[model samples]
Target chain A: MNNHVFRPLYLALAIVALVFLARYLLVPKDFGAHERGYMYGWHRKGNENEWKAVTVKYKTSAYCKECHDDKVAGISSSSHRFIACENCHGPALGHPEDPMKLNVDTRRELCLRCHAFLPYPSSGRSAIRGIDPEVHYPGKQCSMCHNPHNPRIPTSRS
Target chain B: MNRREFLKNSITVIAGLAVPLSALEFINPKELLADKPGGEKVRWIFLVDTQKCVGCGLCVMACKAENELPYDADVSRTWVERYVVTRDGNTLIDSPKEGRDGYTSQKITMGDGTSRNVRPEDIEKAFFVPKLCNQCENPACVQVCPLGATYQTQDGVVLVDRKMCMGCGYCIMACPYAARFFHPVYRTAEKCTFCYHRITKGMKTACVDACSFDARRIGNLRDPNDPVTKTIMSGRIGVLREEYGTKPQVYYLGLSREVK
Candidate 1:
């Protein structure tokens, strides 16, 4: 082969070699090891652990059941059995330790969220007794009249 | 051989050899890790019962608290939408504050460019639909991510790598469900992970646990005995935006055509 043909071949070979070198240096080691798809499953496996390690702020009612057995027992038999303790009270991740207290959400909106009458007859919400905030004791707090632990029974204010 | 013929043959050989060689180098078989312990695989699926949802906004609040998202912010990892259909055959949908404060009003915008409180008599039907990440099997967000920041886990949850996400907003635009959002603090792309941190620990997702009604649930498809799996298999459930072919894992029971 003449110098022209060999020179072009050498140049092409050099370009290919450099491209491979760049890919080796730039591409992550774990890429495409377990991932399947054009570009979907490809990710750093370590990132999965990073997400798994995240601290959960909300605790289940079972956590509350440990300390407040009476309160939990009262709720379990009531209409609010499905509601978690942390839902009404603030997140109890560090309660009784660092904060030593979980603030009881006394905002009227908190009670009214499920209590306020929405005229959705087709919804299961209609099953729950709903009240019109305007006509039904407009300024009074719900806790003053109804005990949340067992809403079926009314609690008189002291 | 002629110079032209020789050059063509050389190009073909090089092209074929380069691709396969690089692919072999990129995939190291020995380093691949098992997806889960005990070699057991899990296929996570979500189920939402619209019939049971009352738009109470408890799930929304729980999601915010559990994820440590801003309390007063308008953004949420999950939210409830209210759909109201009037007597005039006009459908009105409103989710004020993303149903975070619960729906107190029936105020809806009319088709004729007017917004007003909808009287109870004027409305024919209304319901609440909770929205969250669908965690698609063929995710468009994953394909559009330039840095491979968004990925699907072995259990079918799609999570964003905040460290890798450069806040490009590509994934947010790519998501047909409008699931992706910019985190207020991290400023990175964020979406529901099926509460991976909680679910992997054998606990219910925060929203699911917070629900007073049995509205939201998570099930593993790999397990036949799973109650959520049984409901998904036997119940008349449907997914959102099926035409997009994203294969959304979130199943909705009593899904009506009125829901967009």
Candidate 2:
């Protein structure tokens, strides 16, 4: 009787241990150290959720950049390069957690974080006193005015 | 449904009643040739008025300080280009590093015993034009992104999906402004974010903050009350290179010759 009880308990413990081991090895690491973590952790007035660095892992751009340096090199040369890889794409903390759960890049409202109508580093223009991107880039892609890799377009006008 | 589910459904229903007006807040490289033009928020445009600028270098200093971009000889997202058109039908170009740490000026002979730092005005017509991502409405960079790292936002903000970027150079050639700046450390493309991070946080852009001249006036074209809207309403605001029909939003009160 004692052996039977011990065997079942041992099996359960073993199963639980295996599960945790699988998670530790198979799951990706979370957003370790980056600007995105700071943003998710501190910014945004009302959002109060624990910072899960690697929740949406597959779609995260940072995750993509790990193996896609060649593609990222061109962007680094462009105006869009200064920002963090995850800023525009949303929280990429999960993608590393598991490769399969990741989907595509989700940029619903993050794109206007920069690359607005007025030239950046503008001399006579105020970056954000009253400008609104929703009103400006409505129903369109921001690429209309800029090229990510090379920015020397002669001009963008009527 | 269980009582818990019913209660949750009722709460949601009640929440729907509270939808007030204040409610909504709401790439790159590939094979060394990809184009990441933008992201979800459409990229906007930037207009430079060479005619009005005096080459103060205030914008340059402001950008570096605001963004906290480390000092590097190889990288410059925003810099000023001074062009001097001499009286003898000759033009001289002078570009300065975007920094307060120091700057460089190359001396050149303009004409009859006239030597200057190749300033914008020494040639004949003097003017300084700032350059960055044009944030075109129809960016060529987007077309070339193999990994689709470059993208534009709904509000016309061109952005790069840094993660998706493959560090390609195709989009670099596609752009006409030479705005895309490759990061030395990350080896990714970069440039001015329009201080988007700041702008979204209700702060002015880095360069705009640096400029005390009131040259950079960022406002909504849709809002008639805003200064930009008022300026357009008041008089003629010029958008450079009209032939492309990119529908750029950045307007110039006093622009120099066409962007070539």
Weakest lDDT window of 10 consecutive positions for candidate 1 chain B: B25-34
**Each prediction's DockQ?**
0.54, 0.02
What's the lDDT for all of these models?
Answer: 0.83, 0.49
Model 2 Cα lDDT, one tens digit per residue, A1-158: 67988998999999999999997885335312222222111122111121111122113244458877786787777554644343333334335563334343333233332223222232222232222555765665544564534444523644
- Per-residue lDDT for B1-260 in model 1, tens only? 99999999999999988886543432111122224445446878889999999889988888888887898987898999888888999777876667888876556644466667878898788899999998887788998988877888767789888877899999999999998899999999999988899999999899999887889998887777789877877788888988776778888998989987
Q: Report, for candidate 2, the interface RMSD.
A: 15.3
Worst 10 residues of 1 chain A by lDDT: A30-39
Which candidate wins on TM-score? 1
Compose the digit string of candidate 2's lDDT tens values, residues B1-260. 99999999999988887775233211111111212344222223344454444344546644654444565554576776655555676666556354232112234334355656543333444445666665655566655656545655444445565655678877777666677767666666665666665444444555654443455655544334555555655655666554554444566666656334
Instruction: For model 2 chain B, give the 10-residue run with minimal summed lDDT.
Output: B25-34
Q: Give one digit per residue, the lDDT tens place, for model 1 in A1-158.
A: 68988998999999999999998997667655245454677776778888889898888888888899988887888887878898788888887795798889987778888888888877877777889988888888898889888889888857
